[model samples]
Target: MIQRFILLGEGYTDLYELFEIARTNQRRLLRLVQLDTVISGQKKSSLVVILQPAEPGKLMPLYLSLEGVYPPEEKETERYQLFEQLSHELDAPIHRLEVKPSADFNELELYFQYVIGVLRLNRFIPPLQ
Candidate 1:
């Protein structure tokens, strides 16, 4: 299967949109992931929702809310709480991975590719075909 990352926004208020996507597409939901990385000095999280491919589908979508969440360990953020709620509601386990911050990459696209490679390597997503 071919998987592509679709960026929703940089967390903030747009996080609700990610939740809605999961709620609305509950049946198609395959996995939930929280990508954690330290930017500058503070720890942040990017929440991702992976959905199964739709009709005529070779493309599986990985919806991302880029590094907009405060790591719960340092501070209990409302947004991350909501993500937890989503996990309970969906009966899905939220997978966590430590990754290099997108800022480390020269291009945003390269950063995304790096994440994809990581996800595939961990068997979170299918292998490249």
Candidate 2:
């Protein structure tokens, strides 16, 4: 299966778009993830929505609001609240994990590859075929 991360921009207005996608694609929704990272001594989070592979195409899209939102653990934000509401509505528990910040990578693509590797190792996503 070919799995890829589709970034939806920093969680601001983008959050509503993310919520709508989850609500609309509830049937294909696989898992919700909150990737927590510390960047320059500041805590931030990236919300991700994993979806099952498309039939015939084998393209599995992992939608993400990449490292833009403040960590909901420290403060309550509407974006995080929306994410939580999505979990409740879909009955999908948001899997939370602490990970290396994207700043650690030289390129954004490298950061995505690292996340994909971690996801595969944890069996959250399928291994290469």
Candidate 3:
């Protein structure tokens, strides 16, 4: 299976689009993730929607709204609230992890590789075949 990260945008209005994807594909929903990181001395979070691999093609898409929202533990935001509600509605638990900021990486692809490694290590996603 080829798992790839499909970045939507920073969690501004694009968050709604993420929610819509979850709502529309509730059955295919595998996991919802909240990646916490510190950027420029401020705590922020990135939300990810992991769906099961597509049929025949074996392409698994990990939709992400990269670190743009404030960590809800520090401050409650409407965006995070909606994500929580969606979690309940979908009966999917949100997996939280502390991670290095993407800015720390020299390349964006490297940052994604790091995230994929973390997910695999935690068994949130499958290990390499």
Candidate 4:
């Protein structure tokens, strides 16, 4: 299966679009993740919506709004609240992880690769097949 992160945008107006994607594709929705990271002494989070692979293609698209919202543990935000609400509505627990900020990587693709490795190690996603 080819798992890829499809970044919508920073968690501004694009967050609503992410929610809609989860809501509309609830059946295909596999997991909701909150990636917590500290960037320059500020706690931030990335919201990810993991979907099952598509038929015939085996393409699993992971939708994400990277490092845009303040993690609810540190500060409650409307964006985080909506994500929580979506988790409740979907009956899927939000998987949280602490990770290095994207800025640490020389390129954005490297950052994503790191995240994929972490997810695979945690068994949140499947291993190589």
- Candidates in order, TM-scores: namely 0.96, 0.95, 0.96, 0.97
| Residue 110's lDDT in candidate 2 | 97
Residue 115 deviation, candidate 3, in Å? 0.2
lDDT of 4 by residue, 40-120 (tens): 999999999999987777888999999999988799998999999999999999999999999999999999999999999
- Candidate 2: pairs in clash: none
Tens digits of per-residue lDDT, candidate 1, 1-129, equal 778899988745688999999999999999999999999899999999999998778899999999989879978989999999999999999999999999999999999999999998999998878
- Residue range 1-129, candidate 3, lDDT tens digits: 888999999755799899889889888899999999998889999999999976666888899999978888788998888889989999999999999999999999999999999999998889776
Candidate 2 or 4, higher lDDT?
A: 4
**Candidate 1 RMSD to the correct structure:** 1.0
How does candidate 1 fare on TM-score?
Answer: 0.96
How many clashes in each structure? Answer: 0, 0, 0, 0
Residue 103 lDDT, candidate 4, scale 0-100: 99
Q: Candidate 2: worst 10 consecutive residues by lDDT? A: 69-78
* Native-referenced Cα lDDT, model 1: 0.93
Clash count (model 4, backbone only): 0
Question: Which sections of candidate 3 miss by over 4 Å?
Answer: none
